[model samples]
Target chain A: MESQNIKKKSVRKAGLLSLIPGLGQMYNGQQLKGFAFLAVTIAFLIELVTIGIPAFQDFVTLGTVPIRDHSLFLLVKGTLQIIITFVFLMVLILNVSDARQVAKQYNTLGYVNRSARSMLKNIWENGFPYLLTIPAYFVMLFVIVFPVLVTLLMAFTNYDFYHIPPAKLIDWVGLQNFVNMFFLSAYRSTFVSVLGWTIIWTLLATTGQITLGILTAVITNQKFIIGKKFFRIIFLLPWAIPAFVTIMSFSNMFNDSIGAINQQVLGLLNYIPFVHVSDIPWKTDPFWTKTALIMIQTWLGFPYIFVMVTGVLQSIPDDLYEAANIDGANAIQKFTKITLPMILFATAPVFITQYTFNFNNFSIIYLFNSGGPGDVGGGAGSTDILISWIYKLTTGTSPQYALASAVTIVISIIVIGVSLLTFKKTHAFSNEEMM
Target chain B: MRGILSSTKFNRFFSRFLTYLFLIVLSIIIIYPLLITVQSAFNASDLTAFTLDLHMHWTLANFQQLFTQTLYLTWFKNTMIIAVSTMIIQVIIVTLAGYTYSRYRFKGRKNGLIFFLVIQMVPTMAALTAYFVLGLIINGLDQYWFLTMVYVGGGIPMNTWLMKGYFDTIPRDLDESARIDGAGHLRILWQINLPLAMPMIAVQALWAFMGPFGDYLLSAFLLRSPENMTVAVGLQQFIADPTNQRVAMFAAGSFLISIPIVILFFLLQRNFQSGLTAGGTKG
Candidate 1:
């Protein structure tokens, strides 16, 4: 108790000391934490100086060889090193601020400097959550954050096939890729058309899913329907099957020459009045391919909605319907008034997510027909959404990495903007307050 | 009165008839491709094309070929290693993250949440080049472990959100008492909240399993060796060759992969549905 009367440390002093990376924590009597921070920051700096600096130097020199030699490797290495340094700097700042806050608490509370053991105990108590989450953050930093940063920076560079690193150095050409995409005649037309189709596909596919799902759920929910569980499990099969497998299987079945639909089903339909069914060119012709993609997506997507809507439907209180019944509302009226709004209200965020998902539903398009019909030109096929187009641009015969990066940025902007807008309307963020 | 009753009865009958008719048609459309897949898997012909021939003989040769002629068993082994490892690690990381986000009030929490949401908007495929570069930097270019890390990292944001939402529902009072009784944060999370959040954890685990299992593009990009390929990538290779389009074998492979997944979904159907709707609406 007598030690509690000792003079408290100033937060500003502590902050200034922490500029040396843990000196402040030591001054504030947290030796172990201070030493740990000091050790980590010093190691980080050491690595940057030893490895990062040389890579960056190599990048600046554009390799020892002539510019004709590929130096994309050095550029990538340097860029990654720089990004890592930036993250470390952020961590350093956070550490300093945290030390300052703790020191300030000590000052205000008149908490006397505790022994090293007690300080460690303090960390164990208060820092446990951070400790638990650090591994996740570390993994995410490398896997998600780092890659995203690289992609963003890669957009500014010319890393296309022509500049394949090791033989040719990629130069930082800011906004040239964007200009090429939006202004250049050859690229712009393909960009516009692909974007248009992407939007159309998203809208049509989502609406189809929602319509089919709601209808299925409503019918299944009817008291007259028998074996409801059986119907549901059957419907769930499409979603239950791995989507890639299904898409590939569908691709095979839609094959023009020997496909089941063409050779068997359409062959049967050939006998129908006024129908002349032949090989439908399901994956080849542009028009038919797009149509097939939409249909398959709808099939793949609707089961999820059906499952989600069924859950929502179950939660809808029966009293509302009873009240509506008292008002003499018919089945259609009840559906439109009570069921629809409630489901929409509960599922608005998911609806937006569904749209965004379909917008970037790359695997289905890539696997189903490889975004084919190949006639759209400029490495984009008729069914190529922004995602698949980006994929093709990077992996195509003449890889346009810069253009792909630009497209990625564009797609990110669209998705984030739209999601934010819809999220606001749905009050998803507001729910965080309740927690 | 008699006439009116009869009319109402007729209307009810008609509506029920229409419902059945609609359901039956939708079921056919949905189930037809799967039926064809089954048929193709059994069809003995080397040609993978769908035939209308009713007399086509069923045989086990396609499955036999999948096991012997291709590296199907090796692919399964690789896929299981990746998926299982990813699922276990992901469950741990996501559980901790979700609990942190749910139970703690700290500086930068809101910013962290926003960061997750915004970051998730960027498609993982958008970073293909970066992934390759990352693979090189870590010296894990062709390793299944690297792919597992990617899958785990990719799943974190959504699973974290889901777990957080679930944790929010658990009564804080339960943990409050534990805290008063000298339990630390980790203890409370482990002893009090974990059991309650098992459903969400299970849901996250299932999804993590499926992520690596269903992925084609990433596996194709990361793993170049035929023996290292996952089922999805390996099967695609079977049909990808123009000259050797082993469609029947591919069908057999696809059928084989889907069996366990479909069975798992069935086992976890109720939990999966609740988990999805709960995350979508409440989280």
Candidate 2:
């Protein structure tokens, strides 16, 4: 498809010209795009020079007398500025490459230099994807990326309650918070125990949901079952309701003095053999609270699994089961060999995500009991998982920002690590062939 | 052996009975909390009402008090505004992004996809410190718009992935033909791909709407004033405060809020199932 007649423009020269942000695009006859890129990059640079540099310098030199007291603010602002600048630099590079590629395309097409209007038309046709995605990028940059960067930066500074910004400067402590959390303080024990509970909760909640879900799905899928639609809708109630509403309602229902569970449900249980109860103290008692939380999670989680497994169950070919039956395989054998493996294989990635979700299941812990029935001298509660513990550390009376940030980093690592490992194993990220 | 099995017909009856029993019991367990919430909302009690005493006086006092004595209406209004706005914004952004990612073979596309996947792993609360700092800078604390922005932003990564997956299933020949007909990219996306992917889009919109409707922590953090608070945060105050144990009123409020959502869920149950399973069993 290479054209022999057109004079080819040097891609390298075009790329070099893009150091001015739009020059290369202009050379490639993409005036509007080049100008747009140039304008945005220049505006970003201008902001960086006038405001970002001063803040960054203050961060580096620890500031002079007037601004010295605002070190934390300056540091955070400067770091954010640097991140934005880096983003623009990447954009600049992208601009250069894009320009070079367009020029080469033109050369191949036998078009020496397209007219300005046709160039605009080309952009409107081919550049639509980039144009459409700009808003998404803006949202991601400001909302997710910027905040995450600030949190990461905050981990290195002593920006806790004692170092309230603008009132007292928060200095860079250089892994001191991590040291304190791991080795130097009581927080070490809390972190360890919370991590332990987090894992335990994730395992129990996830497995319980999957087990109950599969059981229900198997039963509901039975031809013997009547009123299948009614049962399905009823079963989905727990999942259909907003989780926070149900969680909070459960919290009240588990109240020892006035709660329905203690007042009516357990009161009836007292009549059963070997069962005696004054009250269960469902939320206040550490053991019961954790157990109740697990049960509640199971109730909340199983329906989704039920729905998924049901879908998988329906999709499973009847011929396999028919073959097993022909071979004289019993119902239990067919289930164990056929249904179980197929469902697990199909939904393994979902199950892993469910595990990860339960690991960070903050609302259930926080909303139910505020991570309460306090344990270990108010640093955390009995039900406090890692995410809830982080919440408490950040929002509690002492507001330990650095410690919280460190914990956040730890949680991110565990979550990301598990997700990556599981995604690889399950081939969750593999591409589906287009139909 | 055949005669012996044929003689034990009662065993088959018992097994079928057990299955039904198990299902019925589990359904009750699942629906019990909802029943209690509904009952409590109508029960005329100033405090926690646990008894099954259906003969007790039923009144609309709790609902009346919920409307008149609290900022319930304001909170409801605020939540509706946020949920609707977030839904619209998130749908638009993710639709465009998803279409772009699906149809385009641009530079950095692979890295961009990986970036989104990695970003999804980072929980939003992990970046609370940054959001707090940002709120202070933008003078956005206590504002619904800022909270809306956060919700829309937070929903994009996962929703975009979902939408892109849905888009992939729609044959590209449609877009090719549209281009042949001289339709532009936007027209093809809006007219061709979108109509086919309507189920997934509806699912995304529902989730986006429900996210802010149910979110407690972020709303509580970003919005401080009572009037500005969303329903989730506002309802929690009834039970959260030590001095004010308003369980019945909270129940009433919860019931009221749940009606529309439950109706929506039932109406779109099929779409919900297909969307979730498709998104789940696929990428």
Q: Which candidate is the best by DockQ?
A: 1
lDDT of 2 by residue, A1-435 (tens): 347666788898899999899999888877777888889988987898898888788777444453345765676678777887798888888898888888887777755335667767776877787898899989988898888887887888888898776767777789998898788658888888888888999999889998999999998999878899999999988877888999999998888787888887888888899978788778778888889999999999998899889989988999999999999998899999999999987777678878888888888999999887869543899889988888788888899988898888888988999899888988876754332
Looking at model 1 chain B, which ten-residue stretch has the lowest summed lDDT?
Answer: B45-54
Q: What are the DockQ scores of the candidates, in order?
A: 0.68, 0.62
iRMS, candidate 1, in Å: value is: 1.8
TM-score each candidate.
Answer: 0.94, 0.94
lDDT of 2: 0.83
| Candidate 1 residue lDDT tens string, B20-53 | 9988988888888888787788898766675545
**Ten-residue segment with the worst summed lDDT in candidate 2 chain A?**
A60-69
Candidate 1 per-residue lDDT, tens place, A1-435, comes to 754687777889888888998898888887777888899899988997899888878767657564445465676677778877888898789878978987887877766345778767777877776877788788888889878877887788777887777666677788888898899999999999999999999999889988898889888888778888888888999988999888988888898887888887888898899989668888778889888888898899898899889989999999999999999999989989999999988777778878988998888989988888774667998888988888888777898877888889899899999899889878866756632
List where candidate 2 sits over 4 angstroms from the true fold: A1-6, A17-45, A61-69, A112-114, A273-278, A433-435
Show the colliding residue pairs in model 2. Answer: none
Evaluate residue A62 in candidate 2 and report its C-alpha lDDT on the 0 to 100 scale.
42
